[model samples]
Structures are given as structure tokens and as C-alpha cells.
Target: MTELDLATKAPESDAQEDSSVDSPTQSSPIMGDHEHCVTDRPAPAGQGPTGEIIKLNDIDVYISKPADYPHAPTRLLLFLTGGTGIKSVNNQIQADKYAAEGFLVLMPDMFGGETAPGGKEAYVADNSVSLLEQVKLKAVEIAKSFLIDMWLARVTEAKIMPILHKVIEAAHEEYSDAIKHGEGIYAVGYCVGGRYVLLLAKGTQEGGNDEESGMMKAGPFIKAGALAHAASVTPDDFKNLQAPLSLVCVENDALFTDEVRKVGEDLMTQDNVEHEVQVYPGVPHGFAVAGQYQESNIMDAQVTAYEQMLRWLKDH
Candidate 1:
């Protein structure tokens, strides 16, 4: 794919409540210890969703249905994966956790179903290139390179939003029985995925050309949204949010810095959007989904953030 086509393929909350203080009702421990794995093992038949890879509008989507599918209705969660690319063990564990909690979770591969060459190891592989260089290279290939001027336009108009439209339509048709109770649609995104969450909430901005382009409007479908370790979000991005949002902020995230967090908060306040921004004291970005940090506090933060996301979805 060319850069533009690759770019096309690549690609919160309410309230003032402190989600950091929220604790999970049940313990959901992350898999493995420190090494992040790429291959995702299937969920045990009766424990969680029967995970499957299905085609949606020519795009491959990894779907995890609740074990008791169609027996009773449940909420639908579009679990967007982070910049590390989808098909990671970390994301699967988290999505299974959501499914275990009774959500029909749909995870789309934002990289047009492409897997990184060396899986999770490629990100941290021992090479002449430094780890930072590796990360930057991956980020560019996945998201950052396309997120320049008109970043929102490039993403919402070209990449994920169309895929989102197809997913929503397919869900209504395929899961009509399971979603009959009007449990409503909710979303959780990480890193670049988080950017997609915000775009859904805000819809098209003033000069976005969405009307002329006829892109799908997510504000009508999504009832609530949450995200962790979001990248490329700005104060101006919050202007047209139509639903409640929750933000799980990492205190030391280089991408979602304190300044950017403050701008988001300030903009939310000004816009009168129901939103929440909770700062986890010492963790770095991707702590929630990746579980890269093994410290007690960070692990606790992950559990708390997960609980908070569920709570927000239920509340809204």
C-alpha cells in the first residue's frame, strides 16, 4: 500500500469522578508477566466468548462473542486496539475480560489486518536500532505519520470511520437477537484507537467536509465511550462530543502529557460535555491494555481503569 492507502488503512467520558479511586468488583488479572505476546489464544469454550476472525466489508475483524450468546441480551463493545497493532495477546486478554463480563466485544484490525513482522517482539527486538527508534518507526507505519494537519479528517474520513459504519450495520443484522434489549453500544479504545473514540463522539468538525463526503455519524449510535493512553487528542477535538466520555490518563504518558490533559479538561468544561479525567499516579502509557508495568500500583491502576470503563458504560 502507498502511504496514503496505508494511512487510510491505519487507524470518553463523563463527569468529574476520579476513576483512579474506582476498584474492580472482581479481580481480572492480566496474562503473562513482563513479555508481551502477539499470538492470541482462544478463550476456553465455557469461560468467555468463542473467539473468531470474520470478514466485514472486506476487512478482517476479530470478534469475541459471549459464551451464552443469544440466551440473553447484552451490551456491545467495540474494543479498539492500540498502536502496537491488533492481534496481540494483551488486547485479546482484555477483550476476553470484557466478554467474560457479558459484552459482545468486536475488535477490528486498524492496520487492514496486517500483522507486524516479528509480532510483539519486533517492537522490543534486540537490534542495532534503539528501542525508541523501533517505537517511532512502528508509530509512523501505524498512525503518527498520517496524523499531521487535518489529522481528524484523515482518520475519520479515510480509515476507521467507514469500517465502523460497516461494523455497526453488521452487528444490527447478525446480533439482532442478542442486542434486542437496547443495551446500547459502547466503545473502549487505546492509543490510536482512543483517537477513534474521540472522533466518534465529536462527529465531524466545522470544516471537516463530512456533510459533503457523507461519512457515517457515530454520535447517534454510540451511547458512551472510554479510552486509555489516547494519542493525538487535543482541546479542540472535544467541541462536538454528543455523549458522555471517560478518560483514563497515565501520569507519565509522553503522548498524552499533563498539558494536553489539562487542555482536554478545560475544553470539556467549556463545552459543557459530561466528562471525567482520572490520572493514575505513576504508570506510563499503555499500562492498562498492555500490562507492561508489573508494579503493584500500576496493576491496581489497570484493574481500576477496567472497572471504571465498565461503570461508565453502565451509567450512561
Candidate 2:
């Protein structure tokens, strides 16, 4: 089969809430590692919004419930955001798209309110600049993750695990009727968010081994997951898979590096993991979230990635 139709083994938005309940975001945990919700009854999807924030662990969780939800239990998915954190327009837009496709999409802010400064401006690629200049910018941003109190340090495993658990609990509580199929959840992540899904894909095994793949159980965590232009993750994160995975990557991402991307590919193709990896050759790291922009509109690369993401969600 083609790379797009791979049978290789591998592993692992937002809108607003219009509810009366006051809700809002932060959940972090370590990598085998760091840790990582949903709601309301909404009608069919639309261009406007198929999502809303509801209170889960006292934080606002952006969610979109498909009209035919719970029909396929795996339709429930947890959406982990990248350095952009949550509540951004890009995230909300993606969440709506997922919900529109019949998936129950949930996203909680992983960085609390301390998201990386600058939004899309900080990430837009400038074709005129030297590649070295672009690489330097990425290096500076990654280095900040190590210093105490930067975005990554603040959302360490210990800090975010509780909230991540509560997110699942909240999902169970919200979709009480369809409890049987609800446990086996799916997850999708963008950028650093993909790191979190791999951690969950690490499964419940303490040594982080998926020897029996028991962790892919009808889980309160995840049954399967997908990653798009992922960043800030390591080989230790993606090598072993407890479940199925769909990875959508880009050509020039420093964070998702050639080394790391190769490991993911080998795991799916060489190793025994069940996975699918798609690399968008000319796009930047955040293409899934409309990272490349034109005047007042996002470029078509975002659309292409969007179609890929939804297809992975459906097939997997």
C-alpha cells in the first residue's frame, strides 16, 4: 500500500461554551510521562461552531459533540494542543472541523494561561529569511522549555496528571447514557500536543512497555490516537505503541526532527507497531492549525492537512 494507506503499526480545538456553567483550561503530567474533556448536547456541525466550553476540574474545556455521537464509541477523542496552548482561534476552528465529522472533540488548555507568547505571528514562516534565521528562532523557543517556569516546565507530569484524569471522568459523567462504548477513546494532537498522546499511548504499563498492548484496552484514557506536525516529543515517546496511531508530519520541523520522525516510521514499518505516518513535504510544523497564512485567510496546506486528519480519525 501507499504511505497514505499504510498498515504499519505505530501509535498516537476549540470553540466556546454557550452553557450557563462557568468553565475554562490546564492539564499537564511527564513523558511514559507527562500527563495530559468534553460536554454538552449540540446540534449538527456548522461553519460557526459545533463546540462549547464546560467546567471540568474548574477549568474550561472546549468540546464538540457530534449529532450522531456515541453511535461509534471511539468517536470520543481528546485533543491536545501545541505550544499555542488552547482557546486560540486556530484550535477552535480545528475542533469544529473534527466535530463536524462526527467525533466528540475535547481540548483543555495544557499551559494554563501561560501559553507561549506571540500566537501565529511567532510561527509564520518568512520565505525571504535564511533557513538559519528560522532555525535560530526555533532553537530559542525550545531552549525556553528547560528553564524553570517556562511553558513546558509548568505543565510537568505531576502537575497535569490529575487534571487529565479528571478530564476522562468528566467525559464519563457527561455521556452517561453510552457508558459502555465511551471508555475506548481516541485522541488527536497538534505539535507538542502529540507528545502527550504518545505518553497516553505509552499505556498503563509502568515500565512503559506495551508488550501485551493491554493499554489499548477500552480505556478511560485512549484506544488510539493521531498526531499532526507534532513537536517537542522524543523517540522514547513514539517507539512503543499500545494501540493504533496516525501521524501527519511536515518536512522542515526542527522539533519533530528527522531523527524522531524516522523512529516513528521504523516503529510502524520495521517494528510491529500498527500505525500510519503522512509527511507533508513543503509545509511548516504548524500547518495543521493553519500556520501558513495569506492576507486575511489561511493557505490551502491547512485544508490538505485537515482532510488527512479527518480521514485518519475515520479509518482508525
Candidate 3:
């Protein structure tokens, strides 16, 4: 597997955490409601994003933070990439942008060792193999099909969440003061990763019932979320979501337009879930990547979508 030129070592301690909490808009008390837990605890680790790679769980992952992260207790903007491979530089640029906006950013390569186009397919195939392995360790009452689905969910979570938790925790360990006063952590996913935002909000998968073979206890990590250009998530899967979620889809994105609408509609109607769904006109599926469209109008549409998210975050 080819690795990007990310500096995988621990970050230099020069970037001091922001100590002030004097914003015009005070953060709402959301994170305080989360009951801190002591489950199977995973010790914290970090991977630097400056073209260095750090190996965690034997997989080389990259991370980065901004120079003037302001040491303020801050929120997080976690980006999950889609079908296309997650380019390290692209993620660093995005993370830098988020840090500039006062958010600690995290981007993980869930593609494992595969390349894009073919890389997404390879991820699913590898997941299938991992599912088989997990099935061998299942309880006798669990059917093979049920075990397979649970295992697949577990494989996905294992590939992504551990690293996510590690990244956030590492930031906290290095900048505890900033975190102690942080606003709240939020998540956003694009394409397949958009679906992942929902999955992460739903928490870890328990055994699925007879009708549904994969079940999850809602996780408290993400307080709010945004999903753009997403696909493959079903409405049944989202009934467990308790966070405020906003979904943005391009008019031309047939995947979200056709199939995902039902999921959005279902979410809108649910009680205790604050959500919004908007379709941008004339943009493509990956328009958020910035250079995907040459037309300024299309770019504007994507920017508008992003602005909506920022506004919602500030409001909610």
C-alpha cells in the first residue's frame, strides 16, 4: 500500500492551546449531558499530519492540527471520505481550514490499503473477510447471516472509530485546558463517510433483532452532524439516531435524491431529533472537494451548503 507523505510522528508541543472563552456566542451545554463512561478503554495516541505516518493497531494513519489552534476548549469536525481515496494533503488542508474556524479536525483513511474506484470495492470485500473471521467467534444462537452483519458493522467501527476516539483524546491530553472549556464535538461525513456519521451517532452495534440483524446503542460522541453527498444508509438504520443531523444533497446526486430522501423524510418526522434536508441545485456529488466544478455557480451552491451547516451549528 502506498502511503501519503504525512509526518506520522507526534506533533510538536509548540502550538499552545487557546485559554480564552470570551466569544460573543457562548456554547450551549450539550457535552455536559454526556455521561462519561468506563467501558473497554482504549489508551490515547496521535498521528501527525505533516507528511509523517504513525502506526496504530498496525495501520499507518496520519493527523494534523493548525498552528494557531487558540488553545480554547473547541469542537471537532471529523471528516470521513467517500468512494474516492482520501488524499492526505486534501485532508490536511481541510483540517487546517476547520482549525482556523476553531474546530479540531480528524480525517481517517477507512479505505485501508486499497486505491480508489477499486479501493471502495476492496474495502467492502475486506470487510466481508473480516466478517467471516468474526462469525467464527459468535454465540451459537446467532445465525450466520446475523453474525455476518454484526461482524461487518464491527469491522467498520474498528477501522474508523478507534482512530477517531484516539485523535480526539490525544488532542485533549495535549491540550486539556482547551478541552475542559470546549464547546462541543460535532461530525460531518461525505459520500460513504456521510452515512458513517449517522452510524457513529447510532453508537456500537448490538445483535440485530429477528427482523434486523444488526443493532446499535446510540453513541454520545457526536452531538450534531451533517451528511452531504451520502449513500447506502437506510431509514431503518437511522431510527436510533438521537443527535441533531443536517443532510445536504446536490440536485444531480441521484443516490441521495432517490433512495436517501426516504431516510431524510423519516428523520424529519421523528420526535426528539433535530434535522434538516436541503438539495443544492446543479452541483455534482463531490462538489465539496472545491475544485470539482469549474462553474462558479456550482461552487457557490456547495459553499451555500457549507454555510448552512455552519449556521446550524452556531444556532443549535
Per residue, candidate 1 scores C-alpha lDDT tens digits across 96-123 of: 8888788888887765654322222222
Per-residue C-alpha lDDT of model 3 across residues 1-316, encoded as one tens digit per residue: 1110101111101001111111223322111101000011111124223433445334444444555555444665666655433453444444455565666555656556442221111111122234443334222213422432343344354455554555444544554544454455577776556766776666443322312212123365566787766644555546677678777765644345444465455654665577777767665455554233346786587668777776766565
lDDT of 3 at 49: 34
How large is the C-alpha RMSD of every model relative to the true structure?
Answer: 10.9, 11.4, 18.1
Task: Give all TM-scores, in the order shown.
Answer: 0.69, 0.67, 0.60
Candidate 2: stretches off by over 4 Å: 1-50, 67-74, 119-149, 176-183, 205-220, 269-271, 290-292, 295-298
Rank list by lDDT: 1, 2, 3
What tens-digit string does per-residue lDDT give for candidate 2 at 1-316? 2232211111111111111111112111111111111111122244355478777756568888777666655367788876555666567767877777777778977666656433222232345545555556445434432332245545565444455566766676775443345446778887667767776776452332222222222332677788776655666665556767788776644445666667666665665667777766654445566332442222465676678667766776
lDDT of 2 at 81: 79
Shift in Å, residue 72, candidate 1: 1.2
Best by lDDT: 1
What lDDT score belongs to each candidate, Candidate 1 first? 0.58, 0.55, 0.47
Q: Name the better of 1 and 3 by lDDT.
A: 1
